[model samples]
Target chain A: MNRIVIGRYIPGNSFLYRMDPRTKLIAMILLMVSVFLIQSFIHMLVALLLVALLLVFGGISVKRVYLGLRPLVFLLIFTFLFQVLFNRQGDLLYSLELHYTVLNLSIAMALVIMWGFTKRFLRFRLLYFLATVAGVFLLFHYLPFGIVLGEGTFSVYEQGLSTAFFIMVRLVIIITLSTILTITTKPTDLNLGLESILRPLRILRINAEEIAMIIAISLRYIPTLLDEANKIMLAQASRGVDFQEGKLKDKVIQVVSLLVPMFIISFQRSDDLANAMETRSFVPGQKRTRLHILHWSGLDTTALAFTCAALIGVILLRVVGW
Target chain B: MNMIDIENLSFTYGGKVEALKNVSLCVKKGEWVTILGHNGSGKSTLAKLIVGLLKPQKGTIRVDGVELSERTVHDIRKKVGIVFQNPDNQFVGVTVRDDIAFGLENLRIPREEMIERIEHYAKRVDMYSYLNKEPQALSGGQKQRVAIAGILAMRTEVIIFDEATSMLDPDGRKRILSYMRKLRDDGVTVVTITHDMREAVQSDRIVVLKDGEILKADKSEDVLKDKETLEKSNLELLLPLEVLHGLEHKKSTNEEIKEFLWQLSLNG
Candidate 1:
């Protein structure tokens, strides 16, 4: 079998791909700080442009980053709605007054939520969701009665719109930088870099090696644990447990049954692993060495310098009160 | 000196059930020894005791003349390593090269030497092409081979297989058994703990265990011929007697195999 492209590492030999993982990790952190430092639209525009340049250099398409953000669609929409509805500052750019049927609106909202929750299990989802929303509004004229809320006025301010736009831009910049980091570096190398960064905790009597081992082992066992969970789920399914179609209560019970066995299996595995590690001559907290030595080259230096300059540039913008 | 010497060794689970009781055995240097028994027959317990995974309550275990104690057990483990039954549980690294490098790293072997030993042992196990592949992507047979290469690269004088092939398929079992043959040929003292009679019969000597005690210990042929003692020990002869003997005398191969194939196809 071919090698699994572990955790979003797209195989390519771009500038970011050739840079050291530690350099990339540090650069990602610095750039993320730089993103939040921008105080004005001009700086936000400049940040977005720099991030776009990074995307091109890393060979990642903007469409791929957009796909990665798909899972956060609901969260992003919620943030936009919350920002638009609540914030009242600066001049009122838009204002509206309307009387609404509180009862019918509540009923429509309840039905739309039901559709949202159940759509995951349904094959034909978009039609149900669209019908539930569109049907309620289309039938509004025919509805018999409604509990009318008095006329309510709401205003959208200039400052509110600007804040919403700023927050959205900042989020996109951070996520894009993260996407570049994840795509360019292997997960193992990422962990190795994290371990090297955490080595300073040794003076506090905290074992960095143990923490790193814990992380590496957890990462290693994720697939094994998933495999175990799958087998347990199958065993439960053979006994006629309906995991696919369930009410919230039934799903809770079903998940408990799976979790208990998964816990037992993992505990037993950990015990066995202690013996296995011992047999391999792994003494806890003992002096150890590494096979993979991190190398620093001119490429890494250049990459680190770029992130540092970006951070400093952001600081300079902040000082100039932009 | 014996490669491994155990005298009157005993281990109890939580101070109630005896896993191994008063069992004494000696493995000569470079010899392959198989501890064969049924499930719950304490064969695994004995292997763990020798490797210092568990402390023996009664007597002494000496590996190459270093007595196993709290102080010396770590050093003994440095000389003896084990490849366990579950290939998934035993794998410790993300990839084949990393897994092999793990044991060497723990032993504090330097980087360049570690790389050389990793390449050599991986090629020996026919997994050099899969050095970058994760353990989850490999089959049970391939993972077990990586486990063996890990122990072999540590340069341990003694290596134990604790029913290592039990979870593998027939093809996987055959591959592991062949590697056992290679390890024995390379003069690494090999101890194979198993319930399978086929795997047991390949060892230089067989020690049958029943109820946490040694039932019989002798050469492979001697133990096989003594069906009465084996039956008394309550181990089933899963291998049919005539076929086992037929396989042993490999020169009578032509007509016997043909007849067996005819019988097999007819039965099918």
Candidate 2:
């Protein structure tokens, strides 16, 4: 529950940190759009090069970059596997044959069980996952102890592999770009940038300042309320309320018992917050000053112009079917 | 002139029940006043009313010579800040620095000055290093200090602590009381609303409230020594301290009082 990968900042002295938050936000969006415009190997290579350049300039080590992608490893693998196995539009590069027998199946199951047991005890989990896969495949191929239950053959296509590779690369680049943005930018600075971006909404009679204040306050309270919920859960657990293991009906009741108190406390908290805000002389939608004044320097302008040009170039590439 | 002056103040919570009834009180400038009451005795309500968070249905409440009303409430709030009870709920910023700037932003302070005041007040409260820290990363006492810093940054002449130390530990309570003493010494009017008798004993004046009415208002020693009125308001007297005060007013010493108490018990 505590493993939040995004919106977490690490203090550093780097060019990205010096850039205006608005510039970073806009540049990140533009980069994401350019990433999606990749149509062939050339575009993919270009995008990969840009992401690598950003990684270097971000002052983040390769290990930290891998750590950033750790949470999405499963999704990346799933996408690759789904594309390779299901999408067959090109000539077959290789034919794969498989047999399922009692001996091999049992051995595979044992390997899986072993992996699960040793997962927490191991440090290099990616290597463990790969090792387990190799062990299962070798067992299925070389060992034959009982009657074969089933046999099948599947073909791997050239196009499917290419497409999967492109997709996985795109996802990693996008996620890594976003991770860099969140790491470099402060949350308060991001809020200020969002308010600035949403300033034109004032023409629609929507107060962007009030919306920003709401978002800021909500972000401020998220950890606090989560702690409160944890406390409530523990208190309920001590009272013989089964939260983790119970019948479905009993679990639902337990959840309700937890949620009702949380809701009551949140409501009372909102009341208290409203009164406190009033006492602080906060009037929503009123003209108020800010503490961290965002200055859009010439360098920030140049950065945004560069990203905008990159976005336009990518769009042109897509339009020309490159 | 009184820092806070309330006359014939009456407040009902949207016609639910009367929280304060015809309450009248005067707090002198730079006075450290503690309002003592049990739960539901309208102590918090009075704090809110003075800060203009709640309107008095039938009375005039003035702060720093300005009457609190719809037109002047904002100005009054700028002059009189509050440190509420709950540290989590009242935290309006994502970080200590931002939270302290919250009130300054509302007051339309310039960016440079806001930073200066935030640093000044945060240092004063010993939270300078926690400026970039989130409220969740802080203990209850630290969060309270940040909350107080937020109020102090507003440069309010009068500060109200509405049961601010109720949720803290002994050390936290003592730390906050010392800050209160410092603020009063700096000529800032401090009104602390609390149910702790020990805290009331340290204030410059004590105003005991009962059923939304001021039962007794006197100097701290006088009010805490008045066992009859304090008991009527569900309060207690620090008897040993009172006996010492009795000696203060006369030529008696601690040994003599001990001897007399021993004789009385023997006779009984």
Candidate 3:
């Protein structure tokens, strides 16, 4: 079977694809910090606009971002409603009978969040960033962008729109960076780089070799685990396990049933692994050679330099009280 | 000196079922010994015991002069490697190269040495090209070959194959059997536990097992000629018997009548 490309990686050779994973990871961190530092509404708008430009350049579809955010839409709405109703310090748009606090959906907080998302989109690829931009644009166009609903007479549509946009933005940034990292870097190099960066933990007596082994195994097992889960689900479905006919509680139980067989299969695999290792005269704590060696190239250096620059810029902007 | 020595060795599971009883066996260095039996005839149990995977309830098992006990079992295990029947179950590493390196790692071999040994053994098993391929993605034969490489990389002087080829296709089975013969020729003690009569006939010594006991231990010719013993043990015979049965009957041989049975039970 051909390799699966489920995550955000589009499998291309663009500049983003050639960057080191460590660089991409640091860039994500820098972008996240920059999101919180911009104080002026115009600065936030500029950040958002930069994100839009990035989305276009990255060639990611807007629909992908929305799809990534689809699962979080509910939580986004729930949080938005909670924030607007409970945050009573702002100018009262409406008052709820349940409490003396005025429901002030703070426009500043909402706009800051939106601005934060725009910066994220700029940092990553286009697919999800575009989706989020479209979702938020449509949301602001319809919903009285900053209207707070009282408890007795809340606008579900307004809450949904606000929540969806926030969620879409977060989803777009995380998915974009994550996908970009995975696509740009092989699993082996990524783990090795992570191990090298984490070498300071050697003071705690942590074995880097063992940690590397665990990471390699876990990464390798992800697909195997997914395959096993699918098999178990199908097998349970054949046995009349009604996965679709469940409330939240029933669905959880159905999922637990699938875990039983997956655990069994994994345990069996581990036992086999133990024996296979024994046969190979493998001794723990022994030195080993790696067949594939990953070196930091010029591209890696440039990528890291670019990420460092971004971080430094964010710190500078904050110091200047931007 | 015998490479493997088993004297009055008996193994019981959970102190209830006796898997092997009063089993005494000896194999010279580089000898190829095949244990033949029906399912649950204690062949697998004995193989596990020899490799220190299971402790003997009574008596002793020694490999390369080191006794297999709680104290020395670890050392014995390092010297004696066993390939199990299921290729899928025996893979330690996700990929062929990694799996082959597993045993070497356990032995604390240096990184450079492990790499050198992995390359050599993988090449020996003809799996050098698949060193990077996922073990789960390989064919049964390829998987078995990788397993063999995993064991061989450890450089165990005594290797036990516990129905290692049973799950393999005919080609895979043939490939492993030939490899076993080659290993035996290279002065490695090779013990094969199998139900395949054809494989048994090719061994230096054939030990028939039944009901947790050794029924017969002799040269391949002697064991293959015993049709009565084969019938009692629920095993079929192989080779020359099938040809002889066809000649005597002037008709097609009975498909159910095993090849070995044709020699002793053709007219009975």
Ranking according to TM-score, highest score first: 1, 2, 3
Where does candidate 2 clash, by residue pair? none
User: What TM-score does the predicted chain A of each candidate obtain versus native chain A?
Assistant: 0.81, 0.83, 0.66
Error of 1 at B195 (Å): 0.8
- A1-322, model 2: which lDDT tens digit per residue? 3556566777888888899998998898888888888788987887898888887887866566677788889889879878888889898987767778998999899999999878878898877987898688677667756989887665679999889999999899888888888788888998899899889999999888888878878777777777888899888888887776677899889888988999999999999999988889998778899888798898898999999999998899888987
Pick the TM-score winner: 1
| Stretches > 4 Å off in candidate 1 | A1-6, A61-67, A88-163, B242-268
TM per candidate, chain B: 0.89, 0.89, 0.90
Residue runs of model 3 more than 4 Å from their true location after superposition: A1-168, A237-257, A286-289, A292-294, A297-301, B69-78, B105-120, B239-268
Candidate 2 Cα errors over 4 Å, as ranges? A1-5, A99-155, A229-265, B12-18, B57-60, B64-67, B128-137, B242-268
lDDT of each: 0.84, 0.86, 0.71
Candidate 3 on B1-268: residue-level lDDT in tens?
A: 8999999988888888878889898988999999999998999989878876677888988888888887887688778888888877766565688778777766767878889999999889899999878755789889888878877887888889989889988999999999999998899989999999988877899999998899999998888878888989999756567455445665444553465365456544
Question: Each model's number of backbone clashes?
Answer: 0, 0, 18
Query: Which docking class does model 1 fall in?
Result: medium
* lDDT over C-alpha atoms for residue B208 of model 1: 92
Candidates' DockQ values?
Answer: 0.73, 0.76, 0.36
